[model samples]
Target: MKFLIDNWYLVLTAVISGGLLLWTSLRGKSAGVTTTEAVRLLNREKGVLIDVSEPEEFAQGHAVGARNVPLKLLSTGEPVKQLPTNKALPLVLMCKTGARAGRAAGMLRQQGYTQVVAVAGGLAAWREASLPVEKSAA
Candidate 1:
């Protein structure tokens, strides 16, 4: 069309922008839960919070009641001894930001975890929400 040809730059920009938006939305949808939703799952569905930080980082501070299972362990593709054997239990994963947790969630899903979600914004978001956090005694 004449109008599209005349404004090809604008049309291209719009198309690229739309593609980026669609990609982000689709990528984000199934990968994470907000702090509030994480809390609801923990309280209402008895979800287990799994912190994927390294031992040193986890001991610094982590979500209260969160169990530490380093990302390295999960990456090995072997059974993580620290993880609960009941895959039916909802597992909420968190890390410093959300990146590691997202990868960890995907790994867990591959392992047949029926209900797994990463905490959006991870532990930083949890702290931002003023949720309880505790340092390891060791």
Candidate 2:
């Protein structure tokens, strides 16, 4: 205990760092939906896939039939007006990364969307899985 007492500051730092790492690992495991799982939900649950990409990026390429409601617009409450489905439909949000989609999903949930989900790996995972993408006609 002499060594720990002499290096109390170092010991405290190590304990705090270890606890933070443990908490982070546990927290990181529960976020987002995998591509296959998302597809299964889409097919079985009739989930509405909402692509939260900008207009230009969306037009370049996006999941076939995905409704493009840019994150900026969605955040501003404009996309809800344009959403084709009612609030009862299951909403799955997707973006280049899961970050924006997660935010969108949270917003949707706050807006009384009970079945809102965020696509785990986002569009990058869909492309990696060899899924079809639709490009807007130039």
Candidate 1: tens digits of C-alpha lDDT, residues 14-117: 99999999999988886699999999999999999999999999999999999999999999999987898999999999999988999999899999999999
Q: In order, what lDDT does every prediction score?
A: 0.94, 0.83
Report the number of the highest-lDDT candidate. Answer: 1
Model 2 per-residue lDDT tens digits across residues 1-138: 999999999999999999999999776654677888888878998888889988888888889879988888877754466565578877878888778898888877777788888877888888999988889887
Give model 1 RMSD, 1 decimal: 2.2
The candidate scoring highest on TM-score is: 1
Q: Model 2, which residues run further than 4 Å from truth?
A: 1-26
Q: What is the C-alpha RMSD of each candidate to the true structure, in Å?
A: 2.2, 3.5
lDDT agreement of model 1 with the native: 0.94
